[model samples]
Target: MINAESQLFATNTSTLPLILIDFDQTITLQDTIGPLGKFGVNFTQNTKPWSYFVDSYLQEYKEHRKHFFDLPKGDFKAFVAQLDSYRSIERASQERLSQYKVFQGVTRQALTDQANLLRAEYLQPGVIDVLQEYKDQIRIISLNWSKDWILGFLKELELSKDCIFSNDLEFDESGKCTGNIIPTILTTGDKQVAIDTFRQQFKTIYIGDSLGDIEALIKADLGIIIGNDRSLLDSLADFGQETEQDIKKPSSLYRVDTWDQIRSLLQQHRSI
Candidate 1:
């Protein structure tokens, strides 16, 4: 079912193959943005706009608590439109929306620490093992909303450049963020573009969760849905699994709860 005519492509890899992961639910245990937004809303003295923004934003995805990590992009007006269409927003008991800016204490130290903590606790326990096991066979790539934050997380993990894609952040002279995100913040559709940019040449596979992963999941030579509920994934291919418990023990796609499952699945596919 590969879209032969589509421009999906990737560079050849003699080294480890590439992997893309959803940051929020797939890696970190919580939606990092809500906290940052909360902090921003508070930092701004609970201004109407900021508070409305926070309240409105969080309320939009209340039903998809699992998809909390998927961040939106572009201007406030556009985001407002997105909210207007979201079922969570429509179902909310109240219509009050606040535009609060919650800053998450994103100093270099705080951000770095948070990334490290996420890697240690929230990320799949055997992530390093999978990466190490496939070190020469796979590469790692990411498409996430907190591009800068993801970049920082990669840096903390010591991943090389070219292994990640995120939005650009402008910093002040003191190295603090200027409270602006790049317009091209990576989204589900953006990963296909990133793949094209790489001109990848290997038999590729992509792993992710949620509707945001539809493009990449369908584009890759092989696609895997990590959290199951594969009504969408089923349409793409036979690769879908639920492994939250395995993720708690190890990280793999073969078993249901660990990153090791991904490693095993890849190995099985490669063997075939």
Candidate 2:
């Protein structure tokens, strides 16, 4: 548990920096999409197999990337425009799941069970410790499909669930999934909007890892990209070309391979 005395630097606790964390590959060792798809398939009846949806989504993503890569690479505006175009692909995939009723019969208890299966195997080492230490200042902002799954995962970690903000699986009064997402967050732009809502209340440190995280990362006071993934940096290099500001500068945006580095960074800010 965090020592309450250590948080006494600020008279108004709301002035402290808010740690907005991303789920999926940022917190877990692997992306949850595939596992989540398999879970949905196991519990619900669908016209096609799980791999069919997976293949279809990948095909569309690959085609989009093929065209995206062919576009002039050095233009930041063009790069952002291209990145935002991914929302259509995301929407199409969601629509396919809804049309097929892929998760229609899943129960809340089943989601909790799936989270338990993932909790021990998927979480990145040291993530739980960092989260527990700064629990009061942390808020999970994710593009994940199920808020309940994230909540369940946090419950397993013995962490608070009050600060999660993400898209959710719709459920009926009978407590079964309705095979539709509430869609509060679907694009990088949507994430930016979520981050912006907190700007007036606290200094923001947004930590994420993906193309979808670009805007939120840039918008925050400090942005930490997890892992050594080059795709995010390579994409930022496009924006780097047109701006006077260097996107890779450590002061504004930093990258790390582990949660220990994040803890170190947060320690430096404990005095603020």
Q: Which predicted model would earn the best TM-score?
A: 2
Instruction: Please give, for residues 19-120, the per-residue lDDT of candidate 1 as tens digits.
Output: 555555555444565454444445545445455665565665565455444334423334323333443342231223211123322454555555555555
Each model's C-alpha lDDT? 0.47, 0.76
State the displacement of the C-alpha of residue 189, model 1, in Å, after optimal TM-score superposition.
1.6
TM-score for all predictions? 0.60, 0.85
Q: What TM-score would candidate 2 get against the native?
A: 0.85
> Candidate 2 — which residues are off by over 4 angstroms?
1-12, 65-75, 156-162, 241-250
Q: Lowest lDDT 10-mer window, candidate 1?
A: 93-102
Backbone clashes (count) for model 1: 56
In model 1, the Cα lDDT at residue 174 comes to 78
Alpha-carbon shift of residue 240 in model 2 (angstroms): 3.5
